[model samples]
Target chain A: MLEGISYTDTKKLTAIIKERFNLDFSNYAMSSFRHRVSVAISKFNLVSADSLIEKLLNDSYMFDLFLKEVSIYTTEMFRDPSAWKYISETVLPKLASQNEKINIWLPECTSGEDIYTIAIILKELGLTQKSNITASFISNSLMTSFSQGYEIKKMELNKSNYLRFNEKNDFSEYYSISNYKAFMNSDLLKNVSIEKFLIAPMINPTMVNLIIYRNKLIFFNSILQFDVLTMLTNSLECGGFLFIGAKENIINPEMRKHYKVISEHERIYKRISKN
Target chain B: MKNKIILIGGSAGSFSVVTQILTELPKNFRIPIVLCLHRLKHVRSGFAEALSLKSSNPVIEPYDKDRIEEGKIYIAPANYHLYIEAHKHFALSTEDSINHSRPSIDVTFVSTASVYKENVIAIILSGANNDGAYGIKRVKDLGGITIVQNPEECQVSTMPVSSIRIMKPDFILSSTEIIKYLIDINNKAFFGK
Candidate 1:
């Protein structure tokens, strides 16, 4: 049997976590939190949570592991066809008409696949040269991985997913295959750049015409979700477009009022003026 | 009485099993529950809303930095690991998937063990492959409590039986019995223990 840490230890650990991460977990379901910590501790080969915390406090490497343990970074290119379609059909035209520089943010961009895919789509649409585009990612490691354009052979599945999103073009045309790996065209990275930062603050201060922070909010507790939505609402220029995951919605009564649904099923919203 | 939290992990036939478990639990129950269910990347439907209709407690797809509260159930949204930070606030991450699953049960259960310790309870339900077994073992290691739905009773026995063989969970009851045990734990935590 796995020996659990004592309640006293758990309290100390929670305090340490709060001090470090600014996350308050007292309201979390206890059983679930305990199990997740155990898994992380086991991975570190540590015998106890207190010891794990000690190591975490002493070694920055453990912080990375802790970040990895707690964060889920799964993403793909053009993840939701309909949402992208909405961007192409509804949002893009408006940006095109204004002829304004378009700034797009992919807050939780994992591995740069999604940003590259969008760049390709813009290039195909004749928007890449005409419009100024910027994409942001959350993890420095992922940014580095994307900069190299070298990925494991595991991307074959994503190739199929790319085909699903853009059937008219051959997905293979965008990359060179080596062994089992698919290396993205170096040209795609010319205009596209990736930066690492947390999501909630990205929305404040950066005034952008469109933000595609899809599927990244589902992991937050209610307060974080609301906070992010508010920040997103505040950051968007009037009439800016906000895209979210198909399963996620701005359901909080206060948050819902700021944006009007553009496509109900696709979870695309357009920010309307508070006035 | 303090409520005992339950964490369940599964993939493949999780939709049906989740429905069955919700159907079996009484409507008046007050314990908090969390789940990690694997799903396709871009599909969207109100999973929490749908489950809430069947569950006694309110069902919600938690937001980032949302606080965990009793009498509410949180589901890992598609494509993210739902983690509990200190003080019961939730943290959603886009870190790489473990065992090929985002919103991995192992990730959630392991994180839970670190924060909840012996106050926790974990269950491995129906799934294909061995995603939750390591997580269940972690739960056991912490002395938090562990349960697995009987393999024979599950639609896919690989997950439950594999956990049984490896984790040696405290119970291997049917889905209905699993619900009963959860309710019993909730009562004990809140009223007796």
Candidate 2:
């Protein structure tokens, strides 16, 4: 639907996607969308956007390719250990006291790394039964892939991060490592659920206590950023927590009014209670 | 240096030279300079602060689409590749790193060369890696003046040497000579002789 060399192309694509699939990508940032389409063009070996549009019109399976190309999926156990340590030592205890049932949301979880990490932490804190996690992905493929679990390929990286984060408990006690791969215990991951959810604007009072949407905002344009962030703030209960990636360094003034800094170094914020 | 934006690419051992150059430049020096340096993914602090502490020109890690302001040194943040638009706004990419590095020197150099064309003043300095080799040639191809740190005078010569092998540079200056060259060009441009 998109034509060459202007915003008109992406606008057309958005209309077509909405009309046929009932999915909305209209709020996606134009620069990132353009870059993803460019990558997809090269990846598919299509000469031009016209050819790709033709393929998509003829066959719907091309939607899968578009989905994969646009979203970034990375999974690592305890990716930023210092932040995890802060969450474990400070954040989890605070949340445990506030509510008997701690509902957590990981919006657009690519490979379920952060969600699983949260589950493991909850288990370590003796709050596994008290926790409920809903991890979202746009595609069924992602949901299935994450639910199936993963062999921890980068064991040393995980171990080093965990060691740096918290040496109180031996990192290996949480999972079974065979040869080089760590097979995380299903018992630890019992409270987590993967769901198909597109990030759209909405309001949900007291629905979730914490939302981890790290590093994902870098993929979208500023307009979509503002939209998604507002959606997140509205969805979060008052006094809930939010964590963004380290590289998402600057916080704009508009977002500043809605949250209070828990840890500027860790990029953690607590949603302001507007009561 | 020549009334154009100065673009510098370095990795590994070039940090000392970069600090020296920035510290030497006067606060009045007005050409906008950008740095594309390879850095660790998890090191989100210290580099910009360290540079700012030493340089006359304030060093900053720019946000996405941050406008180009003259007389300040801009460094690419960790885990993002930086590019400049003709509109003079910084753009960043989080795609999988090229040359095993985010904030890749060559990626930024290529974008800068395209935008600034003949007005680009590019310098490839000391580094242990080959990231800036093709970038120097790209600037040269676009009629932008390219300079390399003389390999004989380098702390780690791999990057400068690789760039030199790719194409003949307009100048191969030592650190002292580089500062001198920059000052000379600044004077020439300002005084119109």
Error of 1 at A48 (Å): 12
The TM-score between candidate 1 and the true structure equals 0.71
Count of residue pairs whose backbone atoms collide, per candidate: 55, 1
Compose the digit string of candidate 2's lDDT tens values, residues A1-275: 01112456667777887887677777654444565676777788887667767777788788887788777766466776788878888988999999999989888777766776888789888998998888888788878776675566566767777777677778777678677667766677788776787655534454788898887776665567777887888778889999887556334678778889899878889998663
Best by DockQ: 2
What TM-score, computed on C-alpha atoms, does each candidate reach?
Answer: 0.71, 0.86
- lDDT tens readout by residue for model 2, B92-151: 766666677778888788777766888888999988888888887888999998899989
- What shift in Å separates residue B131 of candidate 1 from its native position after superposition? 1.9
Q: Which residues of candidate 2, in runs, are more than 4 Å off?
A: A1-36, A175-182, A202-206, A249-252, A273-275, B1-4, B85-87, B91-93, B114-118, B184-193
- TM-score for candidate 2, please give it: 0.86
The residue-by-residue lDDT of candidate 1 on A17-42, one tens digit each, is 78986755543334344545676888
What's the residue-level lDDT of B179 in candidate 2? 89
